[model samples]
Target: MTSSNGLSSLGPEGASAAARALSLPAESYGNDERLEAMWAMKAYNHAEVYFNLISSVDPKFLKLTKMDDEIYTKFRETFRDLDIKVLDPELLKSAEAKERWRPFCNCYEGLVEDFNFGTLLRLDCREDYTQDNSIFATRIQFFAVEIARNREGLNDAVFSAKSSKS
Candidate 1:
């Protein structure tokens, strides 16, 4: 029953419900500061390795996953209209985009290890993974788009630039 007091007035059931609610995450539901830091570190390392790879070798030959061909094909089929060469911020971060991406992400659930783990994606395939140019994505999403870029000859410019410098 409603009363002047809080949960105590409502009795044990209300108190227990309140206790459960209080136990939920303070910030975002799944967020843990320490775990977030770890994910950031992992994303940074992967970005570095990917940068080094595209810088030295032709991105066409650089495969991030064992099923590179399949990933590329499915990505193209799923997102036929998406311009993978230029990773649009709206496409990456919008609520609409998340809904659109959910089924595509789910397809790789068993095929790719940690497919949904957070990763740093370069907004522009032609540029380095600078802070302003990067956004967080899933591992499979990153692989799919990057593989598409490489196959489409979008990332060849990075190799060309590096070669010119050498």
Candidate 2:
């Protein structure tokens, strides 16, 4: 698929957004050059798929990944004070948060496919996948934070109002 920006999208080419891929249109970027967020499109795809999943299914029935328990547990252990519903930008951007997140994210390196692939994560569980509320993060970080949000019942807000209206 192609984005409106004229650059061909690296997503939706018969591969799950979670798949491991290191290729990009070399013509567009030259051999080694990369976009600041190489996986933004994929991240957007992932966020949409994930949001739809949570909207349709209750958090208790949601299983984000094979390592859901591990990711959620470790995330909670590492970030005891995290406000999952609306994440602080500093938590994902500051140098210090990265320092604290490195070990935790690396733990799933081999166990989860494409664990380090760049992806977009929504800063607020209640928000849609708008550019303003999204941030770049590794797949594992996305899993960890999103899993925690689902399990904590924070993401129920996604479909709560709509469901009630219906």
Candidate with the greatest lDDT versus the true structure: 1
Best by TM-score: 1
Backbone clashes, candidate 1? 0
Q: Give per-candidate clash totals.
A: 0, 0
lDDT of 2 at 101: 89
Q: Model 2 clash pairs? A: none
* lDDT scores in order: 0.81, 0.75
Question: Which portions of model 2 show Cα errors greater than 4 Å?
Answer: 1-38
Over 63-117, each residue of candidate 1 has an lDDT whose tens digit, in order, gives 7889998888888888999987777989967999999889989988999998887
Q: Residue 85: error of model 1 in Å?
A: 2.1
Question: Per-residue CA lDDT of candidate 2, range 14-107, in tens?
Answer: 3443233335433554443334444555566676677777776776678878889888888899999988788888987799999998999888
For model 1, which pairs clash? Answer: none
**Global local distance difference test of model 2:** 0.75
The 10-residue segment with the lowest total lDDT in model 2: 1-10
